[model samples]
Target: MLTGYQVAVIGGDARQLEIIRRLNEWDATVYLAGFDQLKEGFTEAIDLDFDSDQVERLDAIILPVAGTDDQGRVDGIFTNRLLHLTESWLKRTPSHCQIYTGISNDYFTQLTSHINRNLIPLMDRDDVAIFNSIPTVEGTIMMVIQHTDFTIHGSKVVVLGLGRVGTGLARTFAQLGAHVSVGVRSSASAARVYEMGLTPLDMNNLAEEMPECDIILNTVPAPVVQAAVIKQLPSHAVIIDLASKPGGTDFRYAEKRGIKAMLAPGLPGIVAPKTAGRIIADVISRLLKNSNREVDGS
Candidate 1:
């Protein structure tokens, strides 16, 4: 149990509520920031202002799974406010304290540099992400079923990118009897895709292969599914872009072509918030415990 370590959980959505609950259960001195919209009764955790003075007392700070954007603004989903994390505020965090976030960007990187402390992106952890991918793929499949007319059993599935999420998506679709084709840049990844019993193709030739596809899942963050690519897709095809905000698909082009395109980020929180929250709590708990052990040893 986290008997002595103090934790500050900043802005997040319903998923974060579970994290706070778990932390409180573990006996951590929990502080809740930007939780004004939440109903009362977290007596174990005090609500604090999101400023340097408040941040300095914590052993660790947990930001939302999306972390702050490029402008140093975190999404206050529960409160509907934007919390800014300036460089000076980051510098106020104790040297022994650690920052935990899901993803990183230029703003986060700059903030960390100013603080001269490491920021752990939990989403970058292989164990965390692989487990998280299950929920993400399930949610994506649910979206596909909800949006498309064709059954996945016989559909032509095109997955762009062969990263963790992309690989999980391809496998899930393939298992559902879809004819899965993965787009990859490297020959090694292409060969790995082939070894997995799925068709592997170079992303450079996506246009030629687009017309036959029934479902296009783009994991690439850039504009991979642009106007040209969308134009080549069948009118009935559905495009699911699982990348971060503003996803990978060209929404305007897809809409103009009568092809449905959706940016479905944060599938875990949407499909299974409780389970996702528990997973994050478990990982954070382990990390915190390890940190305490090291401190005690020193």
Candidate 2:
């Protein structure tokens, strides 16, 4: 249990609600920073603004999945008010205070480094990524169904990158009766794709497969699907770039060719916030419990 522990959940969407629920169940004293628009209230959680002097007393500070932007502006789905995680505010926190975010950026890393504070990126953990893949694949399938005119069965699908999400998507699509081809950077990944009874293509030769691809799912963060690649795709082809913002696909080129191209990031949160939140809450509680025990020398 997180009894007596003071945690500040800064800003987030619906998933934050489940995180708050888990924290309250553990008996943590949660301070909410940017939830003014939320109607629900927790028995143990208190709504507090960023300017509150009490913010410095936190044992842990949890930011949204996206965390702060390049300018330190925190994303708050619950509030219209601008929230920023300033360096001064961070520096004032207790020496033992740890900050937890889904992903870290230059602003977070540099500021935390200069302040000598610990920052945990939850998405960096393997368990979190693997668990997240389930919802991502489901959401991808949903989107494909909604947008495409034809059935997934007998469709030609190509998945870029053999990472957690890519692997799950490729296998699931293949199981659904689609001919799945995975694009991998390394030969070993290709071998694994073949072992899974799926076709494997070199990332460099991705264009060769584009003309026949009915659905293209890109998990690679780099610009692997350029104008040259999009030029070879059929006009009816749909490209779902699941990479981070400004995804791997050439959106402009795809548009010029009249191909359906979409950039979808954070599909897990959009499609299944409850499940995603539970995954986050489970990992976070474990970390907090371990940390609490260490502090008490237990």
Candidate 3:
């Protein structure tokens, strides 16, 4: 139980609700900020201003999956008010008050470092990423079916990146009878792709591969599918860039060429928020439990 432990849940989307519910069930003193517009019948947690004096008593601070933007603006779906997490605000928290977010940018990292507080990026963990890949693949398949006229069977599909999400996407499409080919940079990944009975191509030399593909799924965060690559694709082909915002595809060029392209990030949260939220809540609960044990010298 998180009894006597004080947690501040900052701005977030639907997933934050699960975290708050889980923490409250564990008997933590939960405080909410940046959720003035939310009327979800929250009874266990108390709402507070972003920079309330009670922040100094916090044992942990939970942020959304996106965390703060470049300017420390927290993403709160429930509120229109601008929420910012300044370095000074973080400094007010106790020394042991750790911040947990799904991902972090340079600005967030710098803020935590300057305050000498631990910052945990949950998405960076393999367990979380692998678990999240299940929902991501499901969402990807949903999009592919919705957007494309052709069936998955016998369609030429190309998946970029052999990471957790990429691997799941490649395997699922291949299993669904699509001719799945993965863009692999390393020889190890290429061999693994081959072992999985799917073809692998050089990620850098993707120009030739685009023309035959029915669906192009990009998981690489960088600009892999540029204008040069998009121009080679069949006009009927659909591009689903699953990387983070501003995905790997050239959106302007794709639009100009009349090709359908979608930049879809955080698919799990979109398609299956409850499952995704539970996954995060479990991890966060365990982490806090461990910290609780440490504090108790048990």
How much does candidate 2 score in TM-score? 0.95
In model 3, the worst 10-residue window by lDDT is 289-298
Predicted candidate 3 versus true structure: per-residue lDDT over 47-94, tens digit per residue: 866556898888889989988898888878888876788888889988
**Mind giving the per-residue lDDT tens digits that candidate 1 earns over 221-243?**
98788887888777898899999
Which model, 1 or 3, shows the larger lDDT? 3
Deviating ranges (above 4 Å) for candidate 3: 209-211, 296-298
Residue 236, candidate 2: how far off, in angstroms? Answer: 1.4
Instruction: Report the C-alpha lDDT of model 2 over 1-298, residue by residue, as the tens digit.
Output: 8887889998888888899999999898999878888887676778765677777778889888888899777887889976888899889887778888988899888999899988999888998899999999999999999989999999999899999999999989999999998999798998999999998898877776554789999999899989988887887899999998778988999999999999998998899999999999899888887784457743
In candidate 3, the residue pairs with backbone N, CA or C atoms under 3 Å apart (3 or more residues apart, or in different chains) clash, namely: none
Name the lDDT value of residue 273 in candidate 2: 95
How does each model score on lDDT? 0.85, 0.88, 0.88
TM-score of each predicted structure versus truth:
0.94, 0.95, 0.96
What order do you get sorting by TM-score, best first?
3, 2, 1
Instruction: Decide which is better by lDDT, 1 or 2.
Output: 2
Alpha-carbon runs more than 4 Å astray in model 2? 208-211, 292-294
Per-candidate clashes come to: 0, 0, 0
